[model samples]
Target chain A: MAQFRLQGSKVLAVDLAGDTVKARNGSMVAYTGQMGFKKLSGGGDGLRGMVTRRLTGERMEVMEVKGQGTCYFADKATEINLVRLNGETLFVESDNLLCTEASLRTGTSFTGLNGMASGNGLFTTKVEGQGWAAVTSHGPAVILRVSQGLPLRVDPGAYIAHTGNLHRALKSGAGWSTLIGEGGGEAMQVEFTGEGLVYVQPSERMTLGGEV
Target chain B: MSYPPQNPYGQQPYGQQPPPGYSQQQYEQSHQATQAGMPLPPQAPPYQAAPAGQFGAPLFQPPGGEGPQLWDAGTLPANDNVNPYCFSVDLNGAYYLQKGKMIAYYGEMRFSGIGRGALDQLLERNFNSPLHASDWVVAEGRGKLLLADRAYDLNSYDLEDGNLTVRSGNLLAFEPTLQLKQSIIPGFLTLIGTGKFVAASNGPVHFVEPPVRVDPQALVGWADCPAPCHHYDHGYLHGVLGGLRHLTGIGGASGEEHQFEFIGAGQVLMQSSEALMADRSVGVIGAEPGIPGAGVPHQQQQHGGGLQGLGNLGDLGRRFGL
Candidate 1:
C-alpha cells in the first residue's frame, strides 16, 4: 500500500501510515500533531550564526526528519518516486532508503564480505528479492547510465547514489583532481564501471567519503 | 639399517665402481662404461671402512675419494624425513613443524625465524619457537597473524603431489602466484578438497602447499599510511578507516557534512548533527591559528612550564614565565 501527497513550499513528504506509504508536499500539508521548537545557544558568532541561518533554509547544514507519522513543512525537494529492481538484492544509502518490503538484516560496514569502513561509514541494506522499498533524499536523485564500455569514475564523497551489478575500484584522472584543492593530493576516487545505475550528488558532501 | 645409494634418475644406473679416492682416470672410465647396462659392483664404490689409525670410522668413501660418500647412502647417518606429503593426525606439532607453510608466534623471538640465527637457536632448544618446529613460522611477533585475522576458502589439496589450492581471503599477506581455485558462495566460506585447512566463518577454503611466488605488493595493497595524502601521519587512524571505506563501502557517509576542530595536539571537536551535542558543543575556544579557531592568536604554553606569573604578568612576563 503506497500513495503520494503534495504540500508546503517545495518540500516533498513521504508519509508511511499504517500499512501504506503516503508521499505528500505543498502548502496543504501541515504539522497536525504537536509543535516543538528548541533554541540553539552558546558557541561563538560563527557557529551560532550558522545555526540561526539554518532556520531560514539558506544554509547548507539542513536538518531532515524521516519516519512514520505526519509532518508540517518541508523545503528544497524536487521530485519523489518508488523504484524497484530484480534479483534478491537491493543497494541503497542509509538516508535515501525509507522502507523495505522484506525484513532487512542491518549490519555495520565490517559485516560485508569485503566492506571496509569506507563511505563515511554509510549503512547499506542488502534487500533480497522483491517487495517494497521506500527512499527519500534532500533533492531529486540523478540516475546515470554506467556500462562496461563506458564506465564512470566518481569521488565517493560526491556519490549521491548508485544501483546494479557494480564493482568499485580506486580511480584517478587529470580533471578529477583539480577540484580536490591540491592536485587531489591523497584523493581517493570511486571507480564504478559496469552495467549499473549510479546516483551522484551535485555538490561535495564532507562525510569523509573520499580517498583515504 | 642402511640405505641404498639414491640414483638421480629413478630409472637408470651409473656404470663401474671407481675406487675410493678414484683417480681422474678411474672417474672417466666409470662415467663411460656405466651405461653398458650391466650392474657391476653397483657401478659406484661400496661404503669404505676406516683404516687402522684413522680418527672417525670411515663410513663410505665417495667414488671420487676427496669428497664425502658420493654413491653410497649407507655412509651417512639416518634422520627423519620432512616430506610434506606425509602427515599423521597424531603427529601434530612434529608434522606441522616439518610440513606447514604458515606458523603463528605467540610472543617474541630473538632472531628472524628464517635466518641461520633462529635455526641454530631452534636446534639448540630442541625445535620450539612459537608454533613448534614443524610449522613454517608465518608471523614473527604477537600481532602478526591474530585469530581475528581474515579467512578465505580452500578448494583443492593433492597431498600425493604436495599441491594445494584455496580461495582468496582478506589476508593482505598472501602469495599471489600460489596455486588456487576460485568459487563463490554468497554467505559462507565452504571447504572443497581434503587435507588440513582453515575455513572462513562465511565459508571459504584454505589449505597448504609448497612455497610459491607471493606478490607482497598485490596482497597487501598498500600500508595504512604512506597514502597519497601529505597530511596523513602514519599514526592517524581516520585515514585507515577512510581507506577501508573507500575499499569496501561498508560504512558510507550519513549524507551530512561535518566540521572537526583540532582542540589541541590530541583533542578534537567534531561538529555534526549526529554528534553527541547534549553536553558537549561542537566548537573550540582559544584554539591556535591555522587550527580550528579561524584566526585566534594561539598561546604556546610549554608542557613543564607551569602557571606561576600567569595571573600578575601581562605580556612578556606571561609569555616567558610559562
Candidate 2:
C-alpha cells in the first residue's frame, strides 16, 4: 500500500514501494525516487468511467504514478485534505480531488440539480473502497457534521465534498420578490440530511446562482 | 525506522496532535497563555465549544480522532470568526452583507436583496447608500450564518457611536445597528453609530496612527478620522527628466510616487500586501457644477474628450513637449 501524508497543508507526500496511486494529471511537483508516470485515458475507471465522464461532462484528467520513493503532489497551492475511507464512499467534485490511492475505486454518480446550480455539471466523482484520498479546497475546508435533526445547508459554490450516508436536495431561497430582483443572494443551496460530514471551503466559487 | 507507526487515517504522520476543543473558559485561558508566549498560527482552531442547545450534535471527530475541528450550529460562534477567513453570525434578527459573501448557514435564514419592498423599512433605518444598494443583501431569521469573501482575512469591528470608512470592496457585512452611508471619496463607504461590521483584507490588518502616508493599495480603511487626501511626490515630477519619466517611463518612475496621506487623531488600517481588492462601483454622483467627481467638466480631465467638446487637447500639450 502506498502511504499518503501531507508534506504541508498544501502538498501531499505519498511514499510508495512498487505501488501505484492515481493522481491529477501534472499535479506531481517533485519526487525523490524512481517513478513511472502513465496517463490514464479515462479517469482510470476503464471504458465505462470514460464514457460516463464524457456523457456527463464530469471529465477528469488522471495520471497513474507508480514507483518506489516519496512523490509530492500539489495543485495551484490550494489546501489539501486527506480522508481515510473504511469500505465507504467519498463523493467529491473531480476538480477538487487531488489524488487517490489506486486501491480506491473511482466512478461517477449523478448529483442532479445540486450540481447544475453549483456550475459543476450534473455528475460528481466518487471514490470508494479502503484507501487514503486527498481533496483540494480554496482554503482549509471546514468539516461540518450532519446527523438526524441537525441538517446542513451549504452554498453551492462553497461546497466541495461530503462523505457517509446523506441525502442532498436543492433548496431555493428565492421567492416572488426574487423575480423583481429582490431575491436573496444565496438563491440556491444544497440541504444535506442524514449522517455524514460535509466539507465546505471558506471561499465561494463564482456560480451561476451566486449573483441571484 | 517504521515511520513512527503511521495511523490508519494518516493524520498522525505529522505527529502534532490536533488541539482538543476548549470550553469558553479554557479557550480564554489558552488564548492568554499563547498571547504570553509564541503566537498561535492564524489558522489555528479559533472557534469555541458549542453552547448547550436543543439540537446539539455530538462533536465530530474524524476517523482517527483528528483533522479540522467539526463545526455545527451549536458550535458555531455568535458574531465571531470561525477561522481567519470565515465568520459565523448567530442571526436572530437581521444582518446586512455584501451579496454572495455567505458560504454556509445552519438554521432558518432568508436572504433578500436590498431592492425588495419588504426590506424597505430595514433599508430606511440602516442603509443610506443608494449607490451601494445593489451590491448588498440582508440575511434575516434564526440560525448561524457564515460569511467569507474569496478566502481573504476576515475581521469584525465593533463601533460604539463611532464611524468607519472602508474600501467598498473590503466591507463584507455589518449589524443593523450601524447605518451605512456613501463616503465623499469615491469607492469608499462609511458606517456610523454602534454595531459590529465585518471586513476582508488581502492580509492581516495593521493599525497605524496618522500623520501617515500609506500606499493606496495597502490601505484597508480608517476609523473616526477624516477621509485621506492624495499626496504626490513633487520631486518625482519636478523637472524635464522627471516629467519625461512620468510621461513615457523613460527613467523608470517609482511606483510609490503617489500615496494616500492621513493626518488626523484616529487610526488607519492597512493590509500587509499591496494587492487591492476589486473596487465596487460606488455609483454615479449628481453631475452638478463644483461637485468633485460628479462627471462634470474639470481642469485636470486627462481623457481625450471633455464636456466642452475640447477634443484631444488634454494630451496635445504633451505632444508639443510643453
Best by DockQ: 2
lDDT of 1 by residue, B172-278 (tens): 12221221222121111122222333211123211111122222211111111111111212121136564444334466544222211111111111111221101
The DockQ figures for the candidates are 0.01, 0.53
User: A113, model 1: CA deviation in Å?
Assistant: 10
List model 2 lDDT by residue over A1-212, tens digit each: 99888876899999999999999999999999999999998888999889988898888999999999999999999998888776778899999999999999999999987789768789999988887999999988877766666677999999999887789999998788778776777888999987677899989888888878
Model 1 interface root-mean-square deviation: 30.5
Q: Where in model 2 is the C-alpha error above 4 Å?
A: B1-66, B299-321
Report lDDT per candidate. 0.29, 0.78
lDDT of 1: 0.29
lDDT of 2 by residue, B256-316 (tens): 7679999977878898898887766656788888777778776764544423321232343
- Per-residue alpha-carbon lDDT of model 1 for A103-180, expressed as tens digits? 232221212322233343423434444343444443333233344344454434445444566776654322432353
Give Cα distance to truth, residue B276, candidate 2, Å.
2.5
What's the CA error at residue A53 for candidate 1, in Å?
Answer: 34
